[model samples]
Target: MAVDPSDKKALNIAMRQKLFAVATSRDVAAFEELFRYYGPRVRAYMAKLSRDGQFAEELMQETMVAVWNKAAQYSPDKGNVSTWIFTIARNQRIDHWRKANRPDFDPNDPAFVPAEIKPADAAFDMNEDADRLHRAMETLPPEQLELLRLSFFEEASHGTISEKLGLPLGTVKSRIRLAFAKLRTALEDRS
Candidate 1:
């Protein structure tokens, strides 16, 4: 059977949508289909990234497991299925690398670690600095403070904060910049 390219593309998208729905609903068949479709590709990608077939295979399995567990976190509006899957694969690879290279330490070895107590004066200075920063933050306008909170404390990108708050990107950036400048000046004066 000769299928047109457009038809193939449409079929792929349809299958992806169905797979997402099934995965979201915790269907074993859907997970099997997804694994069958993406497993080899993920393995190849991880192998290329890690340059080790055995580790890549392990990472691929872990990625698929993570996808199965986090399928419900997928949002079509954020990205497509391939991107979501690849992101998981990439994270699994990173995690595998971190685990493989982690250093083992013995808690009882005096030569393995050093504990230094902070001087009382240094602790008092740190507390004063924190209080000063808190007071400076309080001096910011409500809107600017909210932008700062979203950008720093919440660790959200400015674009995301803009979209979430229904504000323009430029406005969000400018507000955050202004807030930061105010904080810097206030903190420096106190110092």
Candidate 2:
């Protein structure tokens, strides 16, 4: 039977009343009637959003199940039955897309696995590394140490440092490289 397009709002409100009855009284007939009216529409809505027949079918089933389970949560003051069911359909599609796109994390996969590091241990290690690096920087020649500090602490480019220091670009680059090499060697020896 074709419902007049003009009567759609009234029909939706009537359906919601039936759903409320289903919620309060476990009315199987009311639920069956709601499923009959909404199932195809929900499926079509899911199919349009997903563009996958099998997934849409699955989501349609899920939406109906949610409607059945959560019927009690529906309030007429909030929306009509069509609005509530379509919202459920939209959410089901989102959930399905997330599940499909989410990467499967395997605890046994070494490449993807995360190491369990204690927060205190990590902070202590970071402090120790910073102290070692500072000591290494102190051992560098004054000019080279200044270049390293400007490049790192000041976050200046080599060309900018060269301009600021009024030195040749090549000299600034070589000094920074030499400083890094000395620091690396000092840290490696300590390790």
Candidate 3:
């Protein structure tokens, strides 16, 4: 049966609601629909922002992986799916740029490795703890994740990330602070 276009908006709303519910429930088919729908758009967006075909394709995959992993937290009331998905793609591109441009550091430097951490116990499963941490990370807001990624992985100076992302430096700092606070709260009671 041919789908009518007259009620596209309503159809989109219903699809989003259903997809959001299914994704939250870990239904693979519903999540696949979202991936196929937005994957190309994300690739095109990253291509435009990066001006590199291969880089764009790579970042697109990264963004989609993040979306798959984080879909449960999506909220249609807070923002449309496109906006939320695009924001993730944009942040991934920014992160790629930052990593490509990070200053080279000497591997021989002793300070690069933490001294106090125990070497013998490093390989412990700690499966229960890790599962808890993953759940907490899943709960973080997109804005907070973006800020935290920029601050820690990109290591973009507050002024630079703010300028690059067109956000105020204070806002960037605030979001990173909040992201860390959330992580701390999530881990406070764990052993």
Candidate 4:
């Protein structure tokens, strides 16, 4: 019986038979028909992914070659001919991108790391100054210290801090300013 034009299941069955012929007997005519039907659609998919017509055509050729070589491996139980062929095309695109994006150097190699210019001791005084600042921050009034923590540590905007603390924006700003002044005087005294 002839398959109705609207019957998708019949169409897939016919296509699967053609693919099976190619797989089992290496039927050149069946393969040629399959290629002609799928090539343009594969090319269109690749072009949409790569955004380059020439590159898409190259990838389509790769996909068809894979189809020819791997035809025997295809299983209709897993998917139909169209789905199998398109999966090959998608894999070809991913392989192409992976090769293109690979770095020339082994980034994890220690030989590739840049040498430090400063001696380790150079930052010791800077660490000491940070410790002094921390001590000064601990000495501030609780309200001023809280505002400074929200402003500097949390990186909250002054308006956000005001809203969060239920304080006016000006009050938040003034508290933070006073905290900074006290911290400066305290650090100076320690020096």
Candidate 5:
């Protein structure tokens, strides 16, 4: 007797459910699948939010490690896997920001902290929607993300960016507003 493709799909779904269970129960193979599917995208998102390539890489690795440790708590019905994972990545980014403010550290002292290390395969997937959001940043005309990156990322005053970019204050404000609106629409269309 030959097996039907729909039967195969049913089996696959069952297998995925079982995998999710095993993943929740600390099985390494299941964990590896989750990492393979989501890791690069998470890294890309963190990379975009960081100060530079190295810091972003470190934060991305930290985010994935947290995902591994926290996988057991994931609730499939609560949300899709990507959103839940992105939440974890965002929280880690916030934590990195808070930690950046420590006072009076000596690199040679025993109390001094070591620099963060990035994952060996921290390179992002060339094309995940989440990853594209990072690259889609570049899709916006340079003047646009620049104004918006400064406005949101650096919290620079419009006046400040206007001075830096040599544009009229009104033009800077309009471009940032339009850039954000377009990005929102594009992401919504994808979702």
Candidate 6:
């Protein structure tokens, strides 16, 4: 049970011989040796693929069963034992994936919820507020308006707006701040 995993050549030779013993004589002891050596490894591999420990454990069981049933078919000339075993594990995962029963989508899920409907009067007030904001924006000097438009509507940073408009960075920040103040005051007065 204390295999020096680092001594892979020895392990492979042992596995080959044990597998041959299992194949030729149905030696349960030889099969048990192979299982002890490779069981946890195959389970770990299935865990990574399935992301579910119990399901991975199940897949590992299926894979080992396959290894047992197909032991006689193995050929050292074809490939090593580990590759053959892992290949069986991979196929078991794929087979389970193909038949997995995913839960039905929840209709009441928050992501699927429709937005709340607005009352008629509240909708009208929102439109009026938008109009008032638009008029306040129209009152801004073209330069300040352009800076605000580039900064917000275009989602450009103050530094980017400064570069695009060829204005000092400080000036761009100041004008956007001033534009917000002017709009706020104008909209307040209108209301």
Q: Write the per-residue lDDT of candidate 4 for residues 1-191, one digit (tens) a residue.
A: 25553687886787788788888999988888778878999999999988999999999999999998899999989988899999999999999999999978888688988877676677787888899988998999999988988888899999999899999999998888888899999999999
Model 3: per-residue Cα lDDT over 136-161, one tens digit each: 78889988887777877788889988
What's the ranking of the predictions by TM-score, best on top?
2, 4, 6, 1, 3, 5
Q: Write the per-residue lDDT of candidate 2 for residues 1-107, one digit (tens) a residue.
A: 24554697878767877799888998988888888888988988878876888888888899999999999999888878889999999988888778889988887
Cα lDDT of all candidates, in order? 0.84, 0.87, 0.78, 0.89, 0.72, 0.89
Question: What is the alpha-carbon lDDT for the whole of candidate 1?
Answer: 0.84
Worst 10 residues of 4 by lDDT: 1-10
Tens digit of lDDT per residue, candidate 1, span 1-191? 12233575664575466567666677887678778778998999988987999988998999999988888777777766788889988887777778879988778788856887899999999899899999999999999999988888999998999999999999999888899999999999878
At residue 8, candidate 3 shows an lDDT of 64
Candidate 1: where are CA atoms >4 Å away?
A: 1-12, 108-191
Please give, for residues 113-171, the per-residue lDDT of candidate 5 as tens digits: 67666555553433466675875576788888778789888999999998988999999
Candidate 6 structure quality by residue, lDDT tens digits, 1-191: 45577998878888998999989999999989889888899999888877889998998899889989999999999889999999999998887877776667899998899989999999999999999999999999999899888888999998898888899999888988999999999999998
Q: What is model 2's C-alpha RMSD?
A: 6.6
Cα deviation at 10, candidate 1, in Å, is 2.5
> In terms of TM-score, which candidate is strongest?
2
3 or 4, greater by TM-score:
4
Please report, as a residue range, the 10-residue window in candidate 2 with the lowest summed lDDT. 1-10
Candidate scoring better on TM-score of 1 and 2:
2
Give residue 50's error in model 1 in angstroms.
1.5
- Model 6: CA > 4 A from native: 1-3, 101-191
User: Over 4 Å off in model 4, which ranges?
Assistant: 1-6, 106-191
Alpha carbon lDDT at 172, candidate 6: 88
